[model samples]
Target: MHHRATTSRRTLLTVTAAAAAAAATGATASAHAGASGDRRLHGLISRMSLEEKVGQLFVMRVYGHSATAPDQADADANLKEIGVRTAAELIARYHVGGIIYFSWAHNTREPHQIADLSNGIQRAGLDRPTPVPLLISIDQEHGIVARIGEPATLMPGAMALGAAGSRSDARRAARIAGSELAAMGIRQNYAPVADVNVNPANPVIGVRSFGADPQAVAGLVAAQVRGYQAAGVAATAKHFPGHGDTETDSHYGLPRIGHTRAQWEALDAPPFRAAVAAGIDSIMTAHIVVPALDAAEDPATLSRPILTGILRERLGYDGVVVTDSLGMEGVRTKYGDDRVPVLALKAGCDQLLNPPDLALAWNAVLRAVRSGEISEARLDESILRILRLKAKLGLFRDPYVSHEGVDRAVGTRSHLAAADRIAERTTTLLLNDGGLLPLDRRERPNLLVVGADPASPSGTTGPPTATLATALTELGFTVAALSTGTAPSAARIDEAVAASAGKDAIVVGTYNVSATSTQRTLVSRLAATGVPVVTVAIRNPYDVARLGGQRATLATYSWTDVELRAAARVIAGRARPEGRLPVPVQRADDPTRVLYPVGYGLTY
Candidate 1:
């Protein structure tokens, strides 16, 4: 709707240098038409009021249905007048620049429902002063971090794709995932986790990362960026500097990385550099603290040395810098909810995401601006970066996507097949002693399948109908189902043991066994019986570390039904466990020696 000046020469070089670096790495940048729409972008920024410009720096979250009482009243009041809830109220009132879609917000099974909600939000943004379209973003990181579940394609996730051991797999995964997001009117993805999960005990980032190899992670990050952006969705390389080495979950508390500068450069920084080289649209800051980079104990999300000095200067990432969810305890605990947004902005983040209260955060930022704490010029810098990304997405031209083709485009047959391929590729076999795997279902069809219960899903997907038992049943195995809750209690373990008494073999599907003592105990209990026990880690790969006695141990890294089916095939000897270990698992007997080093996998 508005046009501005040509992009400065410095900006042009930033684009060219990124492209040149991609070419050197044998990766290609996404071919975006009208990339030179900066003139229009600048005009839009020039026309924006200071409040509007400041709003562009904060991206908040909104539920699809009214979750809270006040929000319900607001929606009902608006729905009465406009025949639809004015999603624009987020823009018209609070002036949040973007909105992150959670499963609750995009909860409907119908693709049209999700698309219509996105369109409504964007149309509302466009109707107000300056007429800028909102950035519809999601955690379509494909796998355990996915925000849009099925009917979207159920990707096997990062570790699975990484286990495939091919950049081609990474590229293809991102492309399919990105295309689906585009079909859903999602413009940005908080994905391509650049974190290298070096810690086996890491409960949060286990399967979210590609693998443990820094070089491989770098290559995969580049490949995924090319694929996702090429598919018309902006790909983010996140948890910058890195979140992989930390054991603490930032969602709950601050995790500090004590790596020296050199240590960080070696262990944590490679994938981020590679992502910048790949011309990634945005890089999400990690909430973890790197004492080597900034001695203040503040996270990269609130550190100038890390965000501006390291990422902006050393890494030459001139693109947008986005903060992780400001609402998380890692950030919120340090900086009060009202102050985190301003700190993130002052620290160099272009977007402050998921603040507790949008109005309070915006007012705080505005107050900082008025007090000369955050310069108006600096605020405009973030606005320009945000606008440039919006322009790259062509959000300015037309943000509304057609609902007619969305159902056909998202979660296509080809996408599902690609997901299956990756899942099969990433299904790693850590140990298969005594030739115990590929059990003949025809012979040992009387199997006890454990951990296939419908646990509360952490991601956006609705309660899954497909479980390990359901999948095993389809494979002609007489799977006796055991539905343990999120954690297997001692009673559940006893039940598993009793169930195993009559079964030919026990296939225990473990989740986060490293953290959940119940799961670890269940595995040890079953293995102690000396019965044929097979362990399959459906969430993280560290289960084998605790229950090394299992005759057959495997990891699928995610609970996507397709991946579960792939794991079943691997167990049945129909599909090979081609996936290698992405993160190292420590031996129970020896901490010095890794039980299974990275890239370890076995096949029948």
Candidate 2:
């Protein structure tokens, strides 16, 4: 595997001071390896062509498992968009500095497969005329947002860690995740979401955020940054200036956060400041418009005032500034695909991520530089930062990882046990009325596990119900599982109610109950069967407020197998419900009233 060489304490201290100085001065200074490294980086930059430097700023996505040998489906998609049949061809043509992996894109299949893919891509990048190492990155934020699934040491997500209320847990989980990603030859993790989820109604960032409190979220963000970097992976604090309070999903629409200047500073800026203070390797810009920060309708990704003025000047974060996907509607609504990238570069972004049409965006950037819209000097600033990061990651020294290390490090028994312990700590019992939980195994031997088996952000489903049943069965209960879909039809609810009959106790997993009445109806119908019912909010804690009448309720914050099994253990009295609510759940009937305040939890 690509191991980080140990640095002496004296050298580490000097490097830290240098990095702080670089951030304050906004200079593209190489701090990790001192003056010699700086000379080498500058020498490399001076020798690169404008085309090669421009390519270094883009971290594009390609549809393929292998660099040269893509499946038919991946080949068709790659050719249609990138004008290339394989990742190798695409890299040779565009000379992209980085590539992102997504399970949906078939980029991540298994640990060994991912390691091979990483090696292949790195080889392709090394074969380029200028020969730069590719930064292989993925959004393995765990919980609902994990791209690499199964046997990958899946840990509880940000909110779940928030609920667990332990910085050490957050740090440990991130360290394990980072080490695993590094083992698979992935160098960057777009994780430890720093967005403080103050808005419970936020559709995209609800469970992904650490919590609602800015200071608390800031603490966890810093801890996670330390953890990921400690494991030799670049940690990214994302959706900058904060995407926590917004209601719209940037993937579909441009959401405006109406926080005033003072409100923005107090409510949204703490986590970012904390991240900067922790020396986070990179910060990803949000696509949302905050009128207080910038008067223009442009998203933060395209706003010089936000990206340059606020982040660079005010926050003093000199590390790389990467834009969220340019294909997202939030960034695209204000400008064409061609103009968006140029605007982002001018706005102080160092990397452009996943543009919809790579050829169009790449050509646009090239034209901008040639037409004097974007200065070559300006391009060098980003290139220097990108290269400095690559060097710090030890990518220039050795980008390829050993395939044998994949099995040794990706999913070890010790790592999985740590995940289980962390997941167990995150199971928060919102309500356990009349001591209905810790269902007597002897009395409630025959149980029905039914409810919304919601698909995760990765598009994988069934851990909610299927995994719950398996966990309960392992705990010696005779369990029957019925998956009541997230938006269960009335017929599905009827089938669930029928399945609940004659059962000793009914266990229902609710997913985002506030969004749909059908799940609420399903839980209600199951409860009406006159059997003792236990509800687990497998996605978000807000669901508990909507189903207040339920006798027993727990919040897992995610539906991953780790979380579901944790919840099952809590139900079986194998583990205590130690987690507290990370964010408050307000009453559905009255927005002004708080139903379950933050830090609230029940234990028997």
Candidate 1's error at 57, in angstroms?
1.4
TM-score per prediction, in order, is 0.89, 0.94
> What local lDDT does model 1 show for residue 590?
78
Per-residue lDDT over 1-604 for candidate 1, one digit per residue giving the tens place of the 0 to 100 score: 2122122222333333332232223124333322334444555567778888888887777655322222565466545532344455566776668878777553344567778777777756765666666787878776776666667786778888888888998898888878878887888999899998888777689888988889988999999999999988889999998998888999999998878999889978999989998889999998988888998978789999989999998989888888888878998878787778888887889988877666678889989998999888898888878877776676654567887669778878888887777778888998888899988987788888776444544432322323667777888888777766547777877887888886888888777654446776777788888778888887778777776568988888887777778988888888888888777777777778888888788887
Off by over 4 Å in 2: 1-33, 457-463
lDDT of 1 at 15: 36
Clashing pairs in 1: 4-39, 4-43, 64-105
Tens digits of per-residue lDDT for model 2 on 1-604?
Answer: 1121122222333433343233333346455536656656677677678778888999988898888899999999998988899998888888899999999889888889999999989877767656677898889999889899877889999999999989999999999999999999888889879898888879889999989988889999999999999888999999898999888999999999989999888888999999999999999999999999898767999999999999999898888999999989999998999999999999999999999999899999999999999999899989888887887777766677987888889889999999999999999998888898898789899999988866555423455688889999999999999887888899988898888778999998888876457888887887888888898888888887787457899999988888888998999999999999989889989989999998999898
In order, candidate lDDTs are: 0.76, 0.86
Model 2 clash pairs are none
Top candidate on lDDT is 2
Q: Name the weakest run of 10 consecutive residues (lDDT summed) in model 1.
A: 1-10
Q: What is the lDDT of residue 554 in candidate 2?
A: 90
Q: Residue 525, candidate 2: how far off, in angstroms? A: 2.0
